[model samples]
Target: MMPNTTTLLISAGLLLARPISTLAQTTDPNVDNADTPFIQNIRPDRPGQTVTTNMLHPGQVQLETGILRFDPTDASWGTRRTLSSALLRVGFFNHIELRASQGYLHPLPGTSVFNEANPTVGPAGFTPLTVGAKFLASTNQDARSQVVLLTEMTLRTGDASFLNKAYEPAIRLLVSQQLGARYGLEANVGFRQRGFQAADTKLGQYLGTLALNGPLGGNFGFFTEAYTTWQRSTRFLPGLTSGLYWRPLPGLRLDVTAGQQFGNLGTGFTLGGGLSVRLPK
Candidate 1:
């Protein structure tokens, strides 16, 4: 049997060689600080569009639950509210982990475009379930810089009007770099397979995001980000997001996030809050 090179890199970072006594004896008292307690070297995705290259250690588990609201100035559907969305991640190996996410989505009481005329349709709307595998491709010895890849599949098991009944798959690349004592940069590029209903066309889009994060004295952290979606035939849909993370406990992180879209048509804004809870590794 052969060990995976990427896996080796991740282990080297998480399970560093520094002895406990040595780290404790260092002159810099905040050498071990991180943006969030749930993650080792970076903040989670709750409050920003940026995805971290860091992953949970083996036997570690985390749950991210949040509420999100989107108000589209021109959307015929009115407003959309996600009462709750949950992402569960469990580390199965040194550099490999699995994630499952599905958030509940529904329109404000009177603002639904879904057709209730068809009794066969079970529910009004819900986000499709998605599952993915995250693998660490590379990481520095100190865990200050890292690269990771994620492959995901979204099942078309939601309401008929809301889902295209297509098994959409996606791949994302995440990179992280530490610029200074308090600044960290993250970049992401991704591709997804998408198909629509009624429309005879199949579609695909490229997703990209860049973000910067830093600590804000006290148990808090801040981040700003820009992200976009584009295809060859369509104009880019861009958005800017910013948020803050607070660690009230050793294993829990809380966050609030907001984003505004910049496009000629159907522009909108979003606001949300979430919490991450990490279990013993």
Candidate 2:
């Protein structure tokens, strides 16, 4: 019989639990360090909502982008679409990077550009800008554990339809624990102000996300994730997503994902596909 996802997760955890001493005995230091490539593999923050803990090497730049479609519970609102959801990252000093993201969400009737119905909404308009930075706080080589911190601020410059008309700030703590050699587990927690208005300023939205990802074979990999958002007065709004990824070259990756959101007011599903490219300086 085929095993369920829970069973598979449990099995992977067990595999990752093997004694560290046993793993150490199999390592050859010289062999492991013999080959160091000029450019590292591209690490993307796509196919899922949870941002990864991996940081780019110094002097490297990366662009990750894709298209997305969301089917809302209310058919009258129509399927919301994004033509170019993109994030650009530039590595600066060691363990630090600059980041920015922008996307165009097709205008919808009677719906705010960013509504509670969909948590995956992206920033729109040419003027409004969302900028951020990431820092690698700490790392443990033996356990392959990483802790990263991110801070972002959205400027209130943009088209009226797309502007929240205020400074929106956010922060998140991201972590990644490698399970064995092929699998990894990641988690994130954060909070952000959606708007500067009185109603939106009263309570910030909190986010929590967990994900498991690993390789399937030679050039293919997969990931499954669960994420949620909540406020002081509201229940948790959760979602699930899974997808496959392929690497056709050393610095390029392509991926596709599908998922659904669950909420009290309404529910919806999302579909997306994108690519990431890393440029070496």
- Error (Å) of candidate 1 at residue 103 is 1.2
Question: Each candidate's root-mean-square deviation in Å?
Answer: 10.8, 12.5
What is the TM-score of candidate 1? 0.76
lDDT of 2 by residue, 179-278 (tens): 6555778899988896657787558888899999887888788889999988888888899999998987768899999998998443567888999998
Put down candidate 1 lDDT per residue, 65-143, tens digits, no spaces: 8887875443444545454788898878768979998877665574434665643322346678899988888743235
Clashes of each: 0, 0
Candidate 2 Cα deviation (angstroms), residue 246: 0.8
Angstrom error at residue 24, model 1: 20
